[model samples]
Target: MKKLGFGCMRLPLKVKKINSSIDMTKTEEMVDYFINEGFTYFDTAYMYHDGRSERAVREALVHRHERQTFILADKMPVGMLVTKGDTSRIFRHQLKKCGVEYFDYYLLHALNAKYLERAEKLGVFEYLAKKKSEGRIKKLGFSFHDSAKVLDRILTRHPEMEFVQLQINYLDWEDEKVQSRLCYEVARKHGKDIIVMEPVKGGKLADVPEKVKELFALEHPDWSPASWAVRFCASLQGVICVLSGMSDMAQLKDNTGYMKDFEPLTQKETDILKTAAAIIKNEETVPCTSCRYCTASCPMNIAIPEYFTAYNKRLAGEDYKLYLEERAKDKGKASECIGCRKCEEVCPQHIEVVRLLKKCGEIL
Candidate 1:
């Protein structure tokens, strides 16, 4: 199988609204082009694109293509569980929504240390394993977001999980909070196959600092910034696939073109990435992956990611004042945050929502 997977989280949206529908026509074209390019892995979660990613994949990929040609991966939103029966209810709904009887790869989504404990108490692992046994799911695993110590515990406790999905990229590789490298080592230690998510760090690495750009130009001027980020993950041992949330045809084309015959980065290239990480780390603030987990239940309906993107732009010395103004229309401004902390609870990045929103309010 190819090392690249299509992540459905950042699929193009039809509108700027929080609960806006997906742009289906463009998505279908992306799906066709991806399959035609000899790439088959497509991953979606229950809450991706406001609960529409699965159905969109159903219309764009699953419904239109031969099921045997592609690999479909969907995740159980373990963070959304309120009762033990949630595992059963959501699983049945996901099967129906994706227009599939069985999933090629299924995982419990966003397993932080706290959620991992909750999943155990609620019997989520047992439920998903039974589905796998019953042929409703071909493989079962989890996407993790916590530290290495917590990860070691979960992997030790649930040895039945076939693979582990991790948020990995050159930028976050050695991040003290994210611990991408440490987590990768832990997964390898447990002998679990790895599915990499956020290889481009939610579009952060794709748009790099000028210093990093000069360094890349010195090495591989032909390569796009995204190519370097994605390749970094694919080159890692035990990484079965690197998932990129390509939002448009250009992105899809660029990703598929480079990954068609993937090459692992050499020692010198790896050293360049290490230096780039140090430069990016100093400039980064709020480290939001634009996962939009924080915006899902925002009482003020703030476009949190958009504001953060604008803030990052301003810090990067890019023009963002007008852009921020436009995004603030029909959406909650940074000043509207009530400090309820609801968004923080669901946030996988461990960002201080109230605090950051306050900062965004001041500048953006």
Candidate 2:
């Protein structure tokens, strides 16, 4: 397998708000293409697409191909566990949902300081160790979203974790809030291989500012901006797999085309990326990563990520009127935000979502 893993979070959807409305035909085609190209790793979670992501994997890949031909990874939703049995219940449910007898890689999903405490209290690590000993899970790890200090503490306490999945991209490598480099160093200190998520910063780096695009074009006119972002993450030491949440065929093709013959970015290209990151930071756009975790529990049926994407486009001087109109036609607009701040609580980036929505109401 190449160093690229297929991320099953943002699969093509037929409807806007419904997670169960996955476009299975397109997804199956994409999966066939990916596997035919010799990439086998796939990563999904319990909460992704409201539990339909695992089911989609069953339909698209597991049922069609021999299980031995692909490597499957799934996560236990540690953040949502309120009782000791919750972990076991969710794990069993995930196995049935994905139609798998054993997982190639199993993770404790979305661990931060608070979630880490809860996991310890709930004996989540002990449970994972038991599962691994039983041969149900080949490898155990965790996906993290926290500061470097917290990461160090977690790794020191749980040295058994095999790998650490992190949000590593050119834009967030040195970001004060993300501290991608700091977190990565902490993981390496514990001798863990890295699985990179959000290598494009939720597609923001793919649709970069014109100035940054010009810089990239001048240097490597043949490469797409997304290729640069993915290559930057793959170039890092100890990175084993870079996950791309491909939503369509074009993205899958572009990603595999470059990653098939992977090459580390040159020193000149790395410096250019640093300059581009600085330019992006100065834009001061809302730093929403579009994980869509906020929209799952929303009461008003607001499409928070879509609104943020449109608002960011407007900030980048792109005409967003038509986009805003279309979004409003299908889902609640930003003006409909009720100041409940539910979205802000779930946002991994710690984005002030309510304030940003208010600003989006004004501008978009």
Candidate 3:
């Protein structure tokens, strides 16, 4: 385990579906490359890739490799839980889907203030503890997406949680809205091992603003922008692994190449990133992670994530019209949002999807 985990959320799409159609051939290649390079941690969720990601993990990694060689992690879909019974049912279902008898890591998916309340009411944590006790879950944890106060409360109540998955990146490290620093400090204070997600801020920091890019260049000329962001999270003290949702061969190679022999950032390099974060903080960009959670239940079938990506690129002064056109080919334009905020409800980043879609379509 080289502190780099393969996130199966954004597996290469085989074709354009409202959700996604995973290209298994390329996914297998990515998984094999990752394992061959000595990385084993793989993270998937119940709703990732429209609930098909776990099966894809089976096909791409689990079926091909020996179980002992890789560590598989899955989460209970907290948003979709209708009853305490559903937790047990979905856990069993996930085991069958991933073709495994037990999960190396099991989590309460997207544990936030709202979900935490619901999960407690439904006895979700207690059920997971039973699973861990039964050997179905090796380690119990939750992926958090709320404030530090909420985190402290949960950890205090549920000290049984073995680890925590947090969204950590240089850009959001000190952002008031994200509260990455605060949440991270809370996790550290609890004495928990941390698995980092969104280290590159959903690819936004990978293609940063010119000034920010230049700052990174001056610090490490050969390092890619993504390398700096990923390494920033990996360099942190308690981060057990930094998960990158690599979508293609290029991203896979780039991430694994840099992480093969990991190094921590020196004080001066950390200072440069601090300067880079200051410049990025000034940019007015949509804070979407392209999670596609918004489009999961969109009545109009809008390509919400794609629209936001193009809009962000435009804010960066790049050509985005063609990309927008391609993204809107068979899907609803952003103008068709109809003011329904179903997207906002499930979005981990709390983006104003309807309003941002209106602006993105206006640009088109």
Candidate 4:
């Protein structure tokens, strides 16, 4: 398989809203293009697209292709587990949802500090190991969001984890809050192969500021900004795959074009990316990836990512009234957050959601 994996989290949507229905026809086209180009890995989760992504995979890929031709990855939402038997119930449901008898890669999704405790109490690791022994799961791993210390502790306790998925990109590589480098080092220290998520920071790096765009254009005018971002992660030694949640054909083509003949970055390119990262750090923009992970669990049903997008555009000098017009459609504003903190717990970026929502109250 190639280093590029097709991420199904942000499949093309029929509507533009967060809970909009997927455009399965377009998704099937994108899946065909990806596999024909020799990329074989497809990643989906139980909560992605409001539990529609797994079914999208079944419709677009599994029904159309040979089972042995591709590798499919699904996740168990450990954070959403409320009962002792939820693990097995969800695992069986996922297989039925994805229309697969087994998963090539199965993960304990979004393993943070709180979720880790729940997983241990529920005997999640033991359950996954038993499934792996039964040949229902070929590879067992977890997608992580906490600090390096937590990661080290987990690895020490569960040496059975075959791979660790971390959010690694040039922008967040040295970020104190994200701790991408530290987590990468921890995974490598434990001799775990890495699978990278959010390589383009959920499209933030792909559409950077004019200054950063010009920097890339000056040297590699032919390459898309997303290419540079994905390659930066793929260039790393222990990284087995970099997943891009491609939403359209252009993105799929752009990714496969560069990844077909993969190349490690030169020292000069590395320095250029570091400089771009510095400029991005100085910008007064929200770090939200627009993944909508926060919105799924919000008690007040606030459209957190949409508000953040509006807030970011406001920071970029867009009119405030325009943001208000968009916010009207959402029907839930930032001021309605109520400090529940459920959104914060599931966020992969580890953003201070409550504080940011208060700021959004002031700005949007």
Would you estimate the TM-scores of all the predictions? 0.80, 0.81, 0.80, 0.81
Residues 123-228, model 4: lDDT tens digits: 9999999999999999999999999999999999999999999999998899888899999999999999999999998777886767888999998999898999
Candidate 2 off by > 4 Å: 284-364
Encode model 3's per-residue lDDT on 200-275: one tens digit a residue.
Answer: 8877788777788778778678899999999899999999999999999999999999899998888888888898
lDDT of each: 0.90, 0.90, 0.89, 0.90
Worst 10 contiguous positions by lDDT, candidate 2: 314-323
Cα deviation of 214, candidate 1, in Å: 1.3
N/CA/C clash count, model 1: 0
Model 1, TM vs. native: 0.80
Question: So what's the TM-score on candidate 4?
Answer: 0.81
Q: Please give, for residues 246-340, the per-residue lDDT of candidate 1 as tens digits.
A: 88899999999999999899999999999988887686576889998888899899989888888888665457777887877789988989989
At residue 138, candidate 2 shows an lDDT of 96
Q: Where does candidate 3 clash, by residue pair?
A: none
Listed per candidate, the RMSD to the true structure in angstroms reads: 10.0, 9.5, 9.7, 10.3
lDDT of 2 by residue, 90-199 (tens): 88898899999989999999899999999999999999899999988999999999999999999999999999999899888887888999999999888999999999
Which has the better lDDT: candidate 2, or candidate 3?
Answer: 2
